[model samples]
Target chain A: MIRVLEQIGRVFLRLFEETGLWFTMLWRTMAWSVRPPYGVGEWFRQMVRLGVDSIPVVFLTAMFTGMVLALQTFIGFQRVHAESFVGSVVALAMLRELSPVLVGLMVTGRVGSSMAAEIGTMRVTEQIDALEALATDPIQYLFVPRVIAGIVMLPFLVVLGDALGIGGGYLVAVRLMHANPVQYEINTYQFLDMNDVWSGLIKASAFGLILTLTGCVRGYYTTGGAEGVGRSTTAAVVNASLIILLSDFFLTKLLF
Target chain B: MTVATNMEPQSDPNAEPMISLQHIYKSFEGKEVLRDLSIDIARGESVVIVGGSGTGKSVTLKHIIGLLRPDSGHVMIEGRDITEMRPVELNRFRQHFGMAFQEGALFDSMSVFENIAFPLRRHTKMTEEAIAARVEECLEQVHLHGVDGKRPSELSGGMRRRVGFARAISLKPEILLFDEPTTGLDPVISDVVADLIVEMDRTLNTTTVTITHDMKVAFKIADRVAMLFQGHIVEDGTPAEFQRSENPIVQQFIEGRAEGPLTDGTNE
Candidate 1:
């Protein structure tokens, strides 16, 4: 009983410390966001890297997901002779949850992991220290560009994902399932409110913030060596992924 | 060291140190790295701190640059106590310093040219043409030619350090800190880097505080030598004085002796 209590206490202590570092870094990054020498060039470069590069994967995931979701909806609805509702279910689900959540997870793995590895490697090789020595705030120079890019670009990616996903549902509904095209369009439009799409976009932005911070925090404090960077990268992806999933629950509850 | 009449340059009370560390005490986890450590580096000076591995030589340079804060002490850079400054505030102070790390620490993401131009690009409003000209000039000074497009990973250890030196001198900082700049290089390459240090010191007139285990590097580059032992500076003097010093810890370290205070069980 004592040992278990000690373990629980240690975990809580670590969580608090991690939370403190996260908030402190977030605050500094936000403060630095408004500071002079705003790195507009760096931000655009990162947008191209993080957002532009991520579009294809996010697009593919959403498209395939929509197809699968539509197929599943058709299977269940066909049995009940309620096939008219399939388009409504697929559109509502994609707009309200699937597109944003899936895109968040995919970006967390792709961009978040790479950010961790890059920054963690920088830490191990003293490149971050070199930045410090060069009189450039790493938070302002490095984190600002990345975090801002994440927050700004994630919604854009999600909107694209949502479009591709709905289109995929349309393709499957009309072409594969042979649903009436006009009826399917009407049901999809009738079921999805602007709030559903808006809520998902907001959740996407929140997830983006979480993913970017996870990479920065893990890399910022990375020690040991190459092995340490590896560990931090893994932790970055895992933490970002966990944050995305957990926060999705809260966001869905609040937004809905 | 002659106990009766030593000619080593003692810290002149009247001379103003461009950088000073007074009673610095630092520890990592539970291990003490620096305790009651004090040193004064004068303006336009080149002081090479030599020590065995893990003796806080590099830590001293970091403290001066405000990269590491002492647990309790004063780290004054240019008459200002840097230890009291926040990390963000330290950037203003660090502008006065240019440092070259052991592995060069060049950003792997950028080309050699961009790596050298990083400080200039960030800190100055110089146009692209000017940045290009400055980068070429810095590269030429360090004797690296036409290798600007290459990544740090593509360069040899010597080439990387040359790039590191080029980057460090890009800002023409008042103080230059080379942390074991010759550690992983061949002897010939080490001499090349050492010569660059001398040339930089002469041309830029920058105060240099370097940490190294290489006596040859120390002898070639430093106007004065300070030996750190077990977190304290045990001996400090000129090249000739360092060569003639009778201190056992110094002797053991310089001579590579397997027995003495360094190798003695008491320290362990």
Candidate 2:
């Protein structure tokens, strides 16, 4: 029992040390990212890779979510003689919460994990060291581009997710639910204000920052080669998703 | 005081050293890897650091390039201290050197041309045409002219090594550091890499510090050889001097003996 306790204490110490090292590296990377010699081209390429390439998945997920939300909202409001408010509720919910959170989760699974694996591989292979030897700052050349691209492009994806989701609600409510199309459209536009869209965009921006920072931080500290890269990738996605979800709640409370 | 210090025999007045280390000490987890190690390589000289595994050979190279800091020492390049340089200053200092990593480290996402052209595109304001021309020249130097369009995974180990060499020399650095240039290669390929190292030094007049355990490759190209053992240089001399050295560590390593100090596991 004493040995077990001692082992646990050792593991805690190791975690503390690793966290300190990771924070130091992240600070260095963030400090260097804003300086000159920007890889503008790489940033654009990453924007296309992260944002444009992820549209299909975001659209599919949002459409289904919107359809199901409309169905559930209509059923719940029917007993209250307020089924007319179903379209408004579904649209507002999808725009303010579902779109940002869903897109954030999707990107965490796709781009965040890949970034960790790629950077981890580079670290283990000494490519990052090679860049340093050649006088090329890896943070400026690599991390800044991806981070800026993520921040710039994620808002657009969230907007797209919002639009597709609302359209899916429109499809289900008008064609299937036999609702008055004019009333449904009017209710959506009236209830969903600019604040709803802005709030979703805010969430998207925060999620993007959290996702990229966590991914790059995990990857930058990865060691030991293939196994290490694999572990970092998994850790990046899980940690990024958790942070985004936790922060989303805090930000929503503060902003709303 | 200054004049007296300059007059000391420890300072070479005639030939300025291209790279120098002074009282370099580095330790990891309380285990010393380098213990007050100091050495100098003259301009345009090729010095090979010969040591068995874990003799701080690679650590020494990393220190020279400022990848790792000495616990308490100074690393001087072209007579300037780089031990405590800031990021921008370090990058500027590093621009003067190029390193070929042991694994060749080709970016899988990029084609060979892109990988070779990476440094040029990153550092220089060169036009695409000029970058292309430079990439072609580098590829030609490594006898990899037509393979630029291929991905790294499509290439063989030797081809990848050559590509790595091409990328290393792309920026026209004055000093080159090679970490195990001939490691994990067939004998023929090792000979090819060794010849390329020699040819590049002759053509570019570049100062080179190569760390290797392959004595055959080392003897082929090193103008001077330094044998590191137990965190210190046990022998420093010409290849011939090293071959004839009576130092048991150097003799045991060069002869590849399991009975020697390297495999005894007593040093740790």
Please give each candidate's TM-score.
0.96, 0.93
Q: Compute the lDDT of residue A252 as modeled in candidate 2.
A: 95
Off by over 4 Å in 1: B1-13, B266-268
- Considering every candidate listed, which one attains the maximal DockQ? 1
Candidate 1, B1-268: lDDT as tens digits: 1111112223565666788888888999999999888877888989899998888998988898988889998888877999888777888778899999989999998999999989998889999999999999999888889899999999999899889989998988999999998898889988988999999988889999899999989999988898998887888888888889999989988998778898787554
lDDT on C-alpha atoms for all candidate structures = 0.88, 0.86
Candidate topping TM-score: 1
Residue B43 of model 1, lDDT score: 88
Compose the digit string of candidate 2's lDDT tens values, residues B1-268.
0010101115578866778787788999999999878887788889999888888999999999999999997888888889879868998788788788887888878999999998898789999999999999998888876898999999988888889988989999999889999899999999999999999889888999999999999999999888887777777878998899897878888888778766676753
Error of 2 at A161 (Å): 0.8
The number of the candidate with the highest lDDT is 1
lDDT of prediction 2: 0.86
Reference-based lDDT, residue A46, model 2: 89
Model 1 clash pairs are: B1-B246
For candidate 2, what is the DockQ-based docking class?
medium
Candidate 2: the clashing residue pairs are none
